[model samples]
Target: MRADIVVGLQWGDEGKGKVVDYLASLYNAVVRFNGGPNAGHTVIANNTSFTFHHIPSGALRGTKLFIAPGMLVNPEILNEEILSLKQLVSSFYLKIDSRTSLITPADVVLDKKIEELKGASSIGTTLRGIGPAYSSKALRISPRVVDVLNESFDFSIYKKLYNVEFESELWLKNAKKTLKDYASDVREELLEILSKQGNVLFESAQGTLLDPIYGTYPYVTSSNTTASYAFVSSGIPYKYSGKVIGVLKAYSTRVGKGPMPTEMSEDLAMVIREGGKEYGATTGRARRIGWLDIPALKYATEINGTDEIFITKLDVLSGIKELKVAVSYNIDGKEVENFSPLENIESAKAVYQNLDPIPKLYASDISYIIKNGWRAAPVQMRKYVSFIEESLRTKISYASLGAERGMTVKVE
Candidate 1:
């Protein structure tokens, strides 16, 4: 089998890791295609919880895990994540694509410096320097693994250049640390994995809307988080053309700052927060909660060339007075449909259309959006699934009724 992609359809924190973990067992390898330590994916099983940052959710698969070249490697956090995976799960092999870029101490320093200077106006960065790293890459001034690979390369020259350019860019103004020795070859390892024709699974860290190019400007994450990132990072052409799986939350939630058209009130937020545990995996921050924005979901599905969609967390919306799905937006007081990379500024903001919520609560502790108890859990669960099928025009292939792997339902 070829590459199968899994990404969050919402802004972020869309339970992509859990779904990836569940599907990992089916694939021979799971590859993390993009992002740095800024993403956190939580997977719960047997009353034990394991969260991962900068590691593929498929690392839980105990297969060959390859960190593709598209990723920005942070050794410190990668080490912790690997150790955590070892403790949480049984066995897995992780290899980095030598072509992958490195996120040095300078990057983090740069990130914090930007936030420190920008203060409140900062675009809710994780201080991981992802945006700056990507920007440097675009400007053709990035530091790559190849740079560190050349034994005879002038590191002194590299340092002077990086320092001068980095300073000129104002990325790491207050930088106190400097990288001494960086020697890691992800190319050799990736080639070895590829030679085996081993099944490669590409895992994406951020959601679709968070991509720097497509997401809200200055607020989006670095790099294109879409499934295509896997192709670019893995050096495998058409890897995802036939095997992409877009992961969508039954409802939507975004963490930190940004314009969220469907954001809920604090009280309503409490309901979803309690029901869904919508918190960031890396930052431990509370996520912005809202109902499914069909237009937004459709945009991601189309752009990613998503072959299929996986709607998760159906158990949480068992019963509420009424539920809302953002069918389209009212931009500039005009009704329009379709998910374009919005630049209308005022018009780009989403306008949501409301759908009635079901009054029966299927999961009381999971979210407050549902008021009805899950008395007839199975039958009620089916009803919720049908609603999604019609709204998103995608099947509810997976349903997470409870937290454990076994508690999930398979609709297909």
Candidate 2:
């Protein structure tokens, strides 16, 4: 069995962790390929909620987890996450790639300093040192996990270079002690799994719209948040990568500073936010809500080569009288159905089409809808689903009615 990739199609916080947790039982291992503590993947199972920063969401179910070299490791945060999980799920192992880069205390200090310098124009970073750590990796000056494990390495060099105050010796000692049990070369284990035809799940952080290369510039994250990075990030072959599942919300929401063409009125946004509990799992920042942007969703599906789609939080819109979908973008007075990352996206306006709201749906109702098409679905909801299928030309394989692991309905 090849690896199945799960990614977020919209901005971050697309309920990826919940979907991953639901699907994790089908895979032998869940591998985290990119991003860092900046990502907040929240999962709910057995009425217990978990907000994962560095650990894979599958770990809550005792699935074997691997952190790849493409990811940035913040040892302190990871240690805290691990310790917290141990209180609930007892039997779990986290395998960390030796080549993974470390996010030093200096990097954290530099991150806050950079954000402080930006002031009001800051990109709304989580200030978790992810950007600085990635910058260090790109410059080939970052210390790897293996380097941190070495007895001779001096982490004080970072404190001196960045002019940040950190007890490097003490922090390093603690981190070293914490990570000693998890550090290893995970590539060999992944290879063995593939060789034995065992299924793997490569869980991605953030979303396609936050991807550095494909997302809106200057507002994107430091790492590639697409399924295309699975091979390189996991040190696995392209042949082992199977289906790519792109997870999207019923509507759009963004956390940081960037142009949101379909942004809604504050009162309506607040209602949706409260309905969906739209807050960053990592930062706890309230998200900016908007109507579903079809053009952006289509563009993301095309870029990620999404094989199947998972739509989440459909229940959040149950009580709304009407729903507005962004059918296209009017940029410089020209209407376009296709969307490209823009340099001045703030000037773009969304062309919306309103539809009637669906009656309230339960988790089982959604399961029936998925198993049988939209034959029995509400007329307005049918139109919404049809529009999505036609726009992306992909199958809607899963629908999530709530945040719990069992709240998902499978279409395939």
Candidate 3:
């Protein structure tokens, strides 16, 4: 069977974890293609909330989970996550690629020191050693999962290269004990699964706008967050690649420092932030809120070849007096619609089109909409989705009303 991909269209924290969890039940395996500890995908299932950093959100659905080579594995975080899952899930399949890069304590220290040196120019990173780990991998000095399992692996290489001292012995011992069981030839396994006609879901961590190459450079995450990279990271041939499902929110939100042209007023932002619980799942920092950015959304969809869109957190906009969508960007007095704002992000100003307000929805209204379909939604809510669909020229397959898996409306 072909592999379908789920990716975030905006900046990080686009509620992709919940989307993956909701869709995982239909697939046999879920593969995480990129990012690492810095990614926080929160899923609310069985009335229990799970914040996943390294594991796929499909864990609760008992889907087979694969950590691909494109990821950086932090043993401590993965260990804690496994322990937590054990309490709730009886048994789940998990495998890590032997070629996956390892994140060591030395890398964490290097991350902090580099951030400190950046000072005013710091990228507001999670400081989870993601950048440093990727850097080491590129330099061919990073240890892979298989290296940790090897008896001849040396830990002093970090000290010799970075001039830092850590509890190398303890880290080594714990890493071996934590990862030895899960490490395997994930490429071969994925191939075998595809040969057997098993359906797979590729779950991407960060959003396309934060990709290291295509995103707002220097301010973007360390890994490639685009959907096309999913095949490369998962070691699955492009021939098996299937539909690309792009996930976004009713409005845009970003956690770290970057140019968000459609940012709203501080007072309005605080209202939406609190209503949406807009805080970074990994860093707990308050996210910068903005109106839906159509230009950026269009760019993301085009780059990812998104076949369908899944919108989340539409409930957060209820009760607001008015709603606005950024139809274009004004750069140096020129109104531009096609070019991405990131081309001149610092000077680009968002041009918004105001729409009617969605009346405050009660719990019963949300329940009805969830139980029925989009036709049961408020007229204003339906209009909002229509505007977005027309703007992106993509069909919206799903709309999430709340955090629960059941709080979703399947579009007819």
Candidate 4:
């Protein structure tokens, strides 16, 4: 396997960066496959905190990092992130895929305008213009990075985009700058990094649940954030069968807007938050917390084709007295065994139960769960994790005992 995929399994803040950084040592190149500069990922290592957006989480590891074409490139944010990364260490290197399109500031303005029309209720967008940028690219209106390198690339098209296109018009209206003025080909530079690096880790932004076509509707970002996206964005063919690791938290969380059937009350939410710094790295917003939702995870596991699963934030529940897991949901008074969203499923009644914590607290092996809490899992927390393994037929290989790197256990 040449392509290893890494993705978040929860709403957005499931601590994928920590695992990516920890396991990056096993890979050669790390690629940021999808999503734009909207999400924030934090990596904690050597007692320092590193926050990254456009760049893959692996960038913090001082490894070869590629910003793939799947991402909506915002030059300002990308440039700022590169500079910030450079300041973290002396030898940090980052590359931008020339095929990736740049998101002009005009995109942001248009995005805000459209959302404004939605009135009193909005999807809590970052207003970074990611959605608009993707829409433009799909609609063939956005100025792609490859276009800049084309000698035949129409300068008039650029003019039309800025002076005429919605994003361009909005940019000209909002910012002192526009997208047309900043298009460039960083391909040659990015290819050089690929030549020097052999092990590439494709890092996906957002969870599969947030994928445009697959994720929760209207609340999803404008791209596919699965391992498949990594292959498409990096221009790497269906060649290598590398290990794809899906990073999930022991529980669930989401910020902004969406249906969270298993959402916990403010008290239980705060309990988990204090342990893992539940605030988003990108928005600095407190994420909505919930019990581990099996129906949701089983779907994510399948979409990502996750070969191995890594469970994070396991230690956060030490204070919960008891752990609750949501096994299934009751939608419209009917048993919805599958994870598919029910139409008019404004809310789902979570079928939950609690489980006792492992007395060992932190064990290097997952056997401890079987020894102490295995039986308790069914009656208490619902067999969410077990159901995930059975449903996806993939075993979880790692369990995060704590937030720090040393706390992860490689489960066989």
Q: How high is the CA lDDT of each candidate model?
A: 0.67, 0.86, 0.91, 0.70
lDDT of 4 by residue, 1-412 (tens): 3567888766767778888888887776777778888878788777877788877777656676667777887766766776677777887556565567767766787778878988766777778888888887887767565554453233356445545344443432322232333333333444454466555677788888787777788787788877787766766666664777988888888888878888888987897788668887877788888888888887887777778888787666654666777877888888775676535445678887666653324343334554454343322223444554665578877766666666666654
- CA RMSD per model (angstroms): 5.4, 2.0, 1.0, 5.4
Show where candidate 2 strays beyond 4 Å: 361-377
Compared with the true structure, what per-residue lDDT tens digits does model 1 show for residues 1-412?
4567887776877778888888888777777888878888878766778888876776655766777777887665666666666687676666665566666666677777778888788777888878767666665555665554443223344346446333422222211111122233544554455567655667888898888887766678887798777777777767334467778887778776777666667887788788777766677677778777777787787778776666677766755555667777777777777766564533545666555554554444433322233333445455656766776666656666556655565564
| Candidate 3 positional error at 237, Å | 0.5
lDDT, candidate 1, residue 370? 24
Best by TM-score: 3
Q: For each candidate, give its TM-score against the true structure.
A: 0.83, 0.95, 0.98, 0.83
- Candidate 2, residues 154-224, lDDT tens digits: the string is 65566566788877778778878878899988889999988898999999999999999899878889999
Off by over 4 Å in 3: none
Q: Higher lDDT: candidate 3 or 4?
A: 3
Best by lDDT: 3
TM-score of 4: 0.83
Residue 325, candidate 4: alpha-carbon lDDT: 73
Q: Report, for all candidates in order, the number of backbone clashes.
A: 23, 0, 0, 14
Question: lDDT tens digits, residues 1-412, model 3?
Answer: 9899999999978999999999999998899989899999999977799899999999999989999999999999999999998988899899999999989988899999999999999989999999999999998888888888885567566679899898878888899999988998888888898899988999999899998888888889999999999988977899998899999999999877888888989999999999999988888999999999999999999999999999999999999998999999889899999655347886889998999999999899999887778899999999999999999999999999999998998977
